[model samples]
Target: MGFLGAPVVGVDELVDRIDPRPVLESRTIHEGYVFDLVSETADLGEAGTVRREFLRHPGAVAILALDDEERLVVVQQYRHPVGAFDWEIPAGLLDVAGEPPQLAAARELGEEADLRAEQWDVLVDYWTTPGGNDEAIRVFLARGLSPVPEAERHEREDEELGMPTVWATLDNVQEAVLSGRLHNPSTCIGVLAACAARDRGWATLRPADAPWPEHPRRR
Candidate 1:
């Protein structure tokens, strides 16, 4: 629809799409524990072929846990690349082959926060860095929170060790995001999306098992 005298663009064209180009040349430059750096040349038909380098990721999942009082659970963990202990939603990589994303999210929630949820919904999905990396992350909204049994909790290691968790109101988190305080992509997108979904009576939420066609593994 047009707005404020602006031209209306087709809604169908607004979505990101798969425009597969013929790969002219490709090679892995570096192999890392988490992701691989790859360089490739693609034939863009009339636009000509071009080469690019990016990190090929296996995708990931994040959980935005909310309690009955509508407080969100956020975790603080040191990110070496950024050199800061950033606040983020419970999240982890999709490293296990053949595991479902929702299950992965549940696992992250338990492992990172020592919590579990009785209900789950797809909050949002996004690419962390489309220009330089192929990392896609699916965020899930988790409700009906409870602590995991002490005997069954996963041990934290490295950056995860000594991590602290906090429960904040959704509005406060949203403000933090808008004010450029919270920089984690999953946490920012997840909280803002949760607010939007809640405003719409959660009618916009998708099933936890919703198809994620954009995931590189799925492709």
Candidate 2:
């Protein structure tokens, strides 16, 4: 506080808060199956009004499934935009009507890896790109893993067909992430968050059903 007579704010006080601006105008530029592009003009109080365009996402969930051996279950999926087969965690959009995020996470884990978990906790929630998209994603830590029955497994299609699933040590995943080998946002975030949570004995984790007020559907 001595620097320039400015008060020093506590670290805890830096928490993100809700302060939504009123939108003066909004228009959908293009609607896609996954997300929609929209333009908005918002009233910024004394700063005057501003117009911005962003993607209106439906939100998503990712699972950081850790096995008994401290290894993470990861998958390889081809992303056309990036022109690479990215290593990523099992994740899917929250598109289904009235489905809980946890349930959607379980469905994605089962569909992508044929796995199920007995315990679940929320690892982290974040916006993928706040400047240009409203894609809010929640990553969940899932343990006590088990395989889904063969007859009950989901059939893969499109980009998910023949996707490769790998089990790698957490340390190796961290190293790969640090080396820029894993480019998927969810994988990078989940891996790093899992490491941090482990260091704190996972006491900072939120309940699986914790509220997500930032989700578009919730708002």
Candidate 3:
């Protein structure tokens, strides 16, 4: 049978069957504060061989924090790469060794948004750009939020020092996203996923510390 003029197929039939190419050689080309550039040669079996360069990222987390008013907590910060002030969810790099992604998310929420959540759940996971980078991100849904104690607040540094945090309605965020005013990948993914989760009564959300075998930091 066909649906939408396309032949239907079982989910199992859509699984990738090709084996991953074997890496022939790999070397670090540059090391930066956040990630490293690496060049690699791989044997692609029937496709012959190829050499590619990509970033070796340390992974990161984004938090979609919703407060009692159902407003999203977001941060407006300057991203040097894009040379623009981006409206993004509370996020940070997973540079801390051995720190769980959830903990990292919580820490970023506190530091960037100055809020703490008593409830958290895994919303989504995505690769920022698998074609050229190994950067993976986990988006989390946080609720039951309260301001972090002043004494325990984290001081911002560098680009984060002057960044401003705000709370916005989901409708306004969706408009910004659709209008291309907000282009941050994490923010886009987090907001869209949060919207879907909310529509479904958040039944799709996983536990805050859900097992993430695919996250490199966890492995």
lDDT of each: 0.93, 0.94, 0.87
Superposition-based RMSD of candidate 3 using all C-alpha atoms, in angstroms: 2.6
Rank all candidate structures by their lDDT, best first, as comma-separated numbers: 2, 1, 3
Q: Give the per-residue lDDT of model 2 (tens digit) for 1-219.
A: 758898889899988886789999999999998999999999999999999999999999999999989899999999999899899999999999999999999999999999999999999999999999999999999999999999999999999999999999988999999998788999999999999999999998999999999886786
Clash pairs, model 2 backbone:
none
TM-score of each prediction:
0.95, 0.96, 0.90
Best of the candidates, TM-score = 2
Pairs with backbone N, CA or C atoms under 3 Å apart (clashes), candidate 1? none
User: Clashes per prediction?
Assistant: 0, 0, 0
Pick the winner on lDDT between candidates 2 and 3: 2
Worst 10 residues of 3 by lDDT: 12-21
User: How does residue 180 of candidate 3 score in lDDT?
Assistant: 85
lDDT per residue for candidate 1 within 9-97, as digits (tens), equals 77776887866689989999999999999999999889998999999998999999999888999999999898999999999999999
Better of 1 and 2 by lDDT: 2
